[model samples]
Target chain A: MIRVSRYQLVLMLVWTVLATGILTMPATMATFSVRDTWLSSWGILLGGTLCAGLAWCHVRLFPDRSLTAAMELAFGRFAGKLAAVWVVIWLVITLATICREFGVFVTTIALPNTPEYLVVALALACSAYLVYLGLEVVGRVNEFLVPIAAIVFPLLFVLALRWFDWTPLQPVLADGWLPVWRAGVVPAFAYGLEFSLALQWVPYLNNPRALPVDILLSAGISALVLMGLVLITDGVIGAPVAYLNYPVLEVVRAIRVGKFVERLDTWYAMGVVSTLVLKQAAFQTGLAEAFRTLCGTRDPRWSIWPTALLVWSLAYFLFRNSADVSRFILHTVPGYFLFTAVLLPLLVYAAAFFRGVRPASRAGAGEARR
Target chain B: MIGLAVGAAVLGVLFQGWQAVRYGDGPGAGAWTVWGMLALAAVAVSVVVQARWWPDANPLGWLAALFDGITSWIYLGWSA
Candidate 1:
């Protein structure tokens, strides 16, 4: 019912494309990955892109409806509902993880005295309000915010150049590709988080023809940003970056540009806030859509409270703490995301191709080719 | 309502103490920011809770909620 321009959608994506995924989790990952963190980031990018491409193929296969509808067409009623359930659970988990991340960052850096739950509650209310306004507002806000992030991130590094110690990254790839590959775990699947919303983004984009390309471009741009951050942080702080609880904040704190622009992490914190807002908004909107599908309703506004309350309660129990959440992500979530966002779509796309049953003319791949 | 308010106030006091313990050490004075953040958190908890109960209720409630959301990162190790 709401119209969103391709530019707005792409902007929304740019914010989600970065920090919320790999950069947010890199502190834990750097412990395992070591100095090869930047290279590993690229490795994850390749893996996530393949998954996104596969999902895009499925979207192409069923243009009129989303993955939920496509599943109904491909499998019967029961299996379709099951697949829809998986998608919904994935989104709910994503929402909760982001909320926890919000709390972790706040308590660790800015508000040590505050109750973690309070910070999370504040984040949730903002996201709920955004979802209530509909995707268009979310998209426009993302457009405004993403560019500020893009500008500030590089500026953070430039300011840190005064403190740059190139020796730490010197033994680059010293531990070999094994550690790098392991470290890339966080960034690799980070972009795939956005793929969870393919069901929603597919319908709203002004040019479905350009959607995949834009996603691919967004992925590439975000990957570069991750690489730059990894390289700069590693170069500045070296292995100590891995030890710090929150590497990005540490990197910002390390910046002291000739005494005039000290304590810039406060500003860098704004970038963090903006990215989390966009990521949370995207995930919640998708969650709302899935609820609409499951309950057989066209109205998302009516179900917002139930969905928010459920997500809040679920996030409460999902993981024991930030460390537990990080461990779960390190060990399990990537492969699960691969199956849902990557392999399943490919399976469906191959079936459609082999069956000689042509999907709509302007669906995913068809439009991409045009 | 007062019970909840008192509970939040107690949390505020604990938070301020926690800030003093964590970042409120001698030399840096970063803990002053911590005190400010604790105050912000108290305001945030009240605001967010109110919004959840009765959204679009009052402009003051809305502003407090927004402040908390945007400033949630103010207390982190790097955020301040």
Candidate 2:
């Protein structure tokens, strides 16, 4: 059993904040059919945090068993298998999309000469190897990288102070609230808001009761970081940010603090690598857990390679290019996140309420027998 | 397994180089070329190190992976 302190858990959340996957969202959010992009972006905080809260509630209800196990209990054997397959497939696509996006970002800004596919393949491979090392190392690495991001990002924000125009955010509700809501889905699903991945590893918690606090705290922190990004990006780039493909990168490029150590985009590349790895790890963990529970693995750690290969193959085939990948994620992932992370848990909790499934009795040790 | 991963990584790198040469600033914009090579190299090294050399040791690979996801979120959140 890998032991992780509360501090380490918090560090994990902070790393999630730094993920490159979320970094790419502002560009998508800008196209959100709304003038008040920032407002719509902030709206995700409410929806996302509520989803996190629901996850906490489920953990409280199921305690020992994970969300996957709870689904099996609530839905029965056949449907449970169906749900598991959907989730596993969902996670794989999510990983691939993010991997492809990371590749796109790198090639777009840093290395224009590099092949985008190579970047995608390399990112997936790197993330898979990292996942294969197991969770404990992942946690500690978060502890290390999270601080760097926490410091660097704020510093970047501050240094870009001169370029900021507070007036751009005015007339905030200029285009009604509906567009904002539509835009909110992009960020809500795109970021670490899909806390469904938490269900996979929740069973590994040494003290499951303490998990509600971890989940809530992590969710809150992620939202705040997100809000900071929205506000800063808007203030810095203005409304035209919505029109650009890589708004944040462009904004960073636009920052020139008067000669000597400008072009901070390369430094930002480190931040990108950190986040891509996190996204891959979370999805891979979910995939590994599903395999462990369903297939009865002799060694759970051994599952990462085949899973990586599976994701690599799928990503290679799923969509011809980034635009197709974007379309699939934009249309499909939000509803899926809404269902898996929030609705499913709530339904399960409601069932647990009536069916009398004790939360404390759901442990892996206990469930292994069933 | 490590050897296989390394070989795939090498192929990925070669492919990346080929794409970069063939389609300089094409629509894919060389994103595939660069990231593909990186994915292959990084995955190959980490797996070889973990699976072969220190199979039981928990090193820092997992945290590195999770951090990747988190950074993506942060990037998207702040980018716009």
Candidate 3:
């Protein structure tokens, strides 16, 4: 088996939590909360922390098992396989959504006139190679890419600050806390509950004890970045952010400092592509791992290809339009991700307790004490 | 004859330089080649896993074996 350090896992989690939400968060939050857009990021912080914290407990219970394997530990073999199937299917659908969204954004923005199928296929192919190499390589690749996002996001925020106006964010809580909470909580599931996928990386962590802190820190950093982006986007573009499909792109297009810094799409594009690759690789790896467990196979490398085919087909062929992708992410994703990422693990934990099943390591520890 | 010539060229390009043509040109195509080789290596690895693990049956035949044991393994527990 391959091992990854806690630091690597945390880096990957930050991408998982932040990637898809970068462009969409500002618009979605502004749409719901208006001037209270920044207010909703608090809900993001809370929702992300809580979802990850629950997954932390799930990891604590099954230190040595992947999420799917833990389901096997809780349920009978057949039902365990059923649970694994459910998780695999969820990963497939969600991954296809992310892949399709990636295709839409890249083809529409960066590489127009290029075939969408080719873009999606090539991207997934790269992600498949990362999966084939296993988690350690995936973690290292993400570690390399993190600096790109870390640098680009803050720099983008600073450059876009020239347009920041205080008026747009005024009258905070005009609609009170309800709308803010509603706006924040929904996107939190979109960004936060995905921490559950990090639980699959738990068994690979070199320092298992560090998992909780790393989990929270990753989500916390994501929330902070998300919160700052929302505020900056709102302050810079004001009420118009609500209407823009990609507020971050608008924020990028708005940046103009002398001749050199005008419309820093090149910088912004790097950030977008970096996060997109990281997120897709994370999902593809997780889906392949869960799939291997389901098939009772020892290796997950080959399985990545088959799963890539499914993701490619669903992304390019099945999903018809970019609007459908947007609607699905906004309307459908929160509840769907909540069930699989949060509630399913919680149920599996309950089942573990009901069956009086404990982690093998814990049992060994108890025996040692005796 | 011209249509046939064009079709042959297209097929040859797809077969020989599919990675370059399918992905793009320049650095992008180079990145595609590196990952494309890795993807092909993964397909090769799957064959190895198949031969090593399930020489008698299909690669994913664990479920098939479990299906036969359905009545016996209905009750749940560790490794049940």
> Which model scores highest in TM-score?
3
Candidate 3 chain A: worst 10 consecutive residues by lDDT? Answer: A361-370
Docking band of candidate 3: incorrect
Model 3 Cα lDDT, one tens digit per residue, B1-80: 22332233333323433433343333233443344334434433454454457545433233224332331221111011
| Candidate 3 residue-wise lDDT at A272 | 77
Q: Which of the predicted structures, 1 or 2, would earn the higher DockQ when compared with the native? A: 2
What lDDT does the true structure give each of the candidates?
0.61, 0.62, 0.68
For residues A59-163, could you state the per-residue lDDT of candidate 1 as single tens digits?
A: 566654556556545654466556766676667667777777778888887899998777777777788899899988888888777567668777877878776
**What tens-digit string does per-residue lDDT give for candidate 3 at A129-203?**
888888888899888876777687688788788888989888777777766765775557666778778767655
Which residue runs does candidate 1 get wrong by more than 4 Å? A190-193, A258-260, A350-370, B1-80
Chain A superposition TM-score per model:
0.90, 0.90, 0.94
Error of 3 at A113 (Å): 0.7
Candidates 1 onward: DockQ, in order:
0.02, 0.02, 0.02
In model 1, how large is the Cα lDDT of residue A89? Answer: 61
Return the lDDT, model 1, position A52. Answer: 55
Who wins the lDDT comparison? 3
Candidate 3 DockQ vs. native: 0.02
